[model samples]
Target: MAAGAPRIFVSHLSGIAVFDPAGDQVGRVRDLVVMLRVGQRPPRLLGLVVELATRRRIFLPMTRVTAIQSGQVITTGVLNVRRFEQRPTERLVFGELLDRRVTLTETGEEVSVLDLSVHQLPARREWEIDRVFVRKGRKGSAFRRAKGEALTVEWTAVTGFSLEEQGQGAESLLATFEQLRPADLANVLHHLSPKRRAEVAAALDDDRLADVLEELPEDDQIEILGKLKEERAADVLEAMDPDDAADLLGELPTDDQERLLRLMQPGDAADMRRLMSYEDRTAGGLMTTEPIVLRPDATVADALARVRNADLSPALAAQVYVCRPPDETPTGKYLGTVHFQRLLREPPPSLVSSILDRDLQPLDPEAELPAIAGFFATYDMVAAPVVDEAGSLLGAVTVDDVLDHMLPEDWRETEFHLDEEVATDGS
Candidate 1:
């Protein structure tokens, strides 16, 4: 469901089809995983257990889930096919919570849980079980109740499913900071002790940890990554931006890098290897492998649709690169650029190739930092496409990446006084 959507009963979602952005069926939702809090607080909705066509059930984290509507769940098309292994802290909504006997706080009468309603918190991406559908009756493990009166009550009214204690792990901390931005959350993690940091990192979903890792200092990134399992580390790396992932992989021992690369998807591994082939401060090294690339025949509507993606950074969405046949980097032939503003001004069906800015030269893959900075400054551009010797589009180097490389090496240490805020006694 979209943010601010009405609470959805669990029964409505059971057995629903799950599809990727391309509208291809990936699986069917079998159950949901949630983590119960210490008190009467409603459990946090972690993810869905989706059974793929092969009948292998995998965990589809809420972070990767873009929308839930009438009959299907739409994901960001990023799937981790790893088998779903229930963690110590997780509780299955269907298998465990439903048809269970729980006590009503006021009446002291036992009731059977028929269904639970989950809602996304206002203006936040987090979802939680806010209401419980229950009937006053003797407890039995049956989904249907034919006799007693049934009513939907707030989650706080019932008390039967075991609640986690406050001090055990990172569940409390994660719930407390569920709404934090990646950078702000990174600051929180930086202040934590190594053991606690590892705990919190382990608790965070891959997409979240990936964003936080991008904002963390290189040392902190390496430390937290080192503490994770190799497979998980590879998954987190795959979730990160191609440029950032390549930078992290570059710091590891060659053998360690190779091992992680082997665990990653072949396409992602190739991007990392290609990025690592460039000098650290060069355009090729700084550019993200995934850019908004469209073919010559793509319409303004197509370009606008791609730009609407919430996952893209502002700079990356500022413009789109129009190329020849293969609409992926290294794209067929580096044609030209189509700015978002131009897309807006043109008719929806207008061809993007017709309005391209061909006069502006694309950056050479090996362009140095100073030259890249100069190019941005001279053209007043937020992003510029990078092309290789054979005229293939390598990727686009964004202005943020240029400034990141040009800034002092210790910039992240003092970046917004994170060091002082994280220090003991603020010393």
Candidate 2:
């Protein structure tokens, strides 16, 4: 090892392609194997867990790694074909470190470990933990707020935290990720292996899992869904926005979808069936059945109360639907919508119908993707209601869903250019 070796965050090393000295591809890095040692020093990297083209996983000792850089790891063209197994003393970085909560010894505040920086020990073929990037603030409070820069604490400043020691197992480690936005959490989950992803998914509550599942790619969504027990899967599906759940169900084989739907609450099953009835690219298929609804005579105060629901998406909460009797699905009649902004300007006692957007038309449930896009563009609305031939409100399609459909097929894969700029020498 050379002096002043580059310090790379462990996350940057994850998923980078591995190559042999002859320039032949080996396999991508699955995880780092490390052994914890006593004293003030950090754990030592022992080997690389590599998953080959054959779908077989094997171990490549650190001695076989000739070089490591931003986008690839160079090996000496030698590898052990036998499978990699976890030794009693070793810990997998990707499985164990990324989101573990560790208390800051100085502040006595708990922070989630976001990433770990590791570097080669001076003049030796060994790497040890150096710095840790941790996010401050408690869980639920930070989920919706913008997170500031991570506090990079030297490894020694962290103490008395271990999954086994805390007796929380995966739950304690996953608590750190509880504060991440669903989309951000989905991105991190995408990079993990199937097993690790399932472990984390199991740790999340239904609502959080539903939100994250909606953000993940269809294949990933299906994989994680398959891992859950039937009843738990039903609970997660029911918690998801109906449209998102329907979209996911549409991707699975009919028998599996039917089985899972059977386990769901009847009302939720009915809602999903209604969504599944429409063409995937149509407005009905892309709309959520759970928009804030109100009776025509309801007051601004009532509308405001609906807007306060924490589970409602921002777009869905931005307006309230006014209908005749039966505010639930097949909403008795599509009276009109009252923009939340309009409610603010009206007196609290004023009826919602008084400020309704009478001229704002709803989209037909069968409207095609292009028509839906035009509706959003022409009306300058983040969400629009869907109605049946009889003018009964069915659901509301949000701008996020419309944009999701408008994006290219490989949008999610390209969104994170993990290969382009992962590793860099800290200045």
Candidate 3:
């Protein structure tokens, strides 16, 4: 810790309420923002990412922070409600720094960073990292440190393995990304250099990479896909939602797409080929072929479990499809749909067929965008089934995919469009 300077560990700051001079709670600390610099100098603290009561994230500069105490942070009441955008030199302390690998200069042993402390310079507006909490043993739990036994060391005595120090290496990048949600990781990936982005993408597991790819803009998705080996790219495509995978494949040259598709599993390749046959704006093109399917004999409990799958998006999981024998697309037969709400209201052991919305018809595979939108509005459903001429369930269109088609082609690149809830306090 700096001489006579009050300090708080970064981990302890999570969820700490922020109060104005009058002790009126304004928001809570979400993450600490800092600038990454060259040399061994500690990264300069930039501001705090604060979440308002309304759940909007905003930036609160260090200049507005008057005091940092246990359980609460006192601020100058001058909060900037602008959405926090990390600049090229900046990083989030908790997001990219906490839980990272660092080497203790004195012991020459690698340890996991548990927390970091920053201190303001005497009579100055500057705040810089001065102390770090580290735990011995790379595989040990981060919370296993001895009680009241401070392992705080001078920041200069240890080395951070973040992107700035590690260059385009995947290990350090993986360390940071491992803690982030796929969408959050995607946001960070979008801001990195092309080479760095490729390195990070290569380091991610197929499923994790697929999740992150689904969140990236179409252009970014294509560029990163091009960097991967052909076989690995095929695997990632298979892991992605069939709709998203097909859309990306459509952007590639026909021969290139064919070669890559041939590398994928036979079943997956067939599905992608089928999806590619539909126009991009049609219901078939906007649907995922992997919607949870249940036999009529399946119970409500089974329906609930399927919708809770981590891989399925919330919109796609809003309902379950009731199909006849051979519960695969093109399914044996389309019976009806069962909304999750109905499952919750019904007895756990009740058959799914008993609660099926038989009157709810499926969309034709070639249904246009306007028709799909009308179906969602009229039925008040997040997803609707798509069927073929033989009445086989091909897939289900999700509201998110429909919205994507309705928006401009470059909507993902538009800052305001990316996050609908992002707004300012009129400051």
Candidate 4:
């Protein structure tokens, strides 16, 4: 859902049907998954536990939720079907939070949590528990119908639910490291004991883990992925960039790779299979399957919107590939590219085809790492489209991926020291 979406109570969401973009019922909401913050700050609403028709529950990230209507949750139709497993840092709203007693900060009165309200943050996809609907005093006895005072208070007005500053285990550590960048977090995780590393990895949400995994050494990536349950591992892999995920998958034994691939969405699995087919250092292998693709008829406005997606890396967002029908990867005949800068110069209503950069030769799928690196350097381009022999747009190879392949394998393992004072400094 977009930012400023209406607040929704936990009670109202219970058992609500979740539908896809096509209005087909996919599942029912079972519970909410949230991670408690370090202080009185509201817990981030990670996602929902949705039980499907077969009674298998899966995690539905808030990012995938397009809209939340009364008694209905509409998804973007993209879902990770692996069974939901609670992480060390996650809490279940129904299973653990409801009816629990917490102290109200105002009058120091202990209140029972009847419900909690969550709202999407402005200009972001994040959702947080903003308010608590609670009842003061104990529940009424069965014989005498005694009702306690009911009140709704800000989440900060409650003293419980936050992670303890001195708390033990990964939950507290996660809260402390919540703001760390993926690369920085990977560095921290690399130095931790294997056991502690596993604990922290298991506690991270799929997206966070995926990003960190991409930044970690190959050995650490294998070790951590092996520690997770097969289903959860599959979920994390699904969350990763297609090129990164394929690389990780390639390191696994054939049997293990096939198993995880079987668990992934068919389209995602297809992408993985396609990427795995090319030589590891080739343009096809380094290209990300998902790129900003637009049709000839698309306007500059449409291309700009795709380029604005937060999930895309800077390299990938640098330009968009214009193609024929089948806008997805391995799309119909490749047309040309439209750079982000060019799009800015055109009117919003102008068709992207008018300003296409047709002169630049797209990367060949079989182009070796050396050729890929040279192309980026020669053109001073951050990204280039990969087209097949049939002139179909395959995907886009990014400069970062080219550099990754060209760098020494041990480069990521090089240890660098940070000043103790600077390391501890946070402002």
Clash totals for all candidate models = 1, 0, 0, 0
lDDT of 1 by residue, 52-81 (tens): 899988888787778888778998776777
User: What ranges in model 3 sit over 4 Å off?
Assistant: 1-57, 60-168, 414-427
Number of the top TM-score candidate: 3
Candidate 3 lDDT over residue span 85-188, tens digit each? 66544788878888777887777888788788877887676688888888776544444564333377888788654336344468866885677777767877
Model 3 residue 339 CA deviation in Å: 1.0
How many pairs of residues collide in model 3? 0
lDDT of 3 at 141: 41
Cα error, residue 389 of model 2, in Å, equals 1.1
Off by over 4 Å in 2: 1-169, 415-427
- RMSD (Å) of each candidate, 1 decimal: 17.1, 16.3, 11.2, 18.5
The C-alpha lDDT values of all candidates are 0.86, 0.80, 0.82, 0.86
Q: List TM-scores for all candidates, in order.
A: 0.59, 0.60, 0.64, 0.59
What is the per-residue lDDT of model 2 for residues 145-255, given as tens digits with 9 covering 90 to 100?
336546788887886432222233557546657667787678667755566678889988898899899999888999999999989999999998899999999998999
- Quote the lDDT for 350 in model 1: 96
By lDDT, rank the candidates, best first: 1, 4, 3, 2
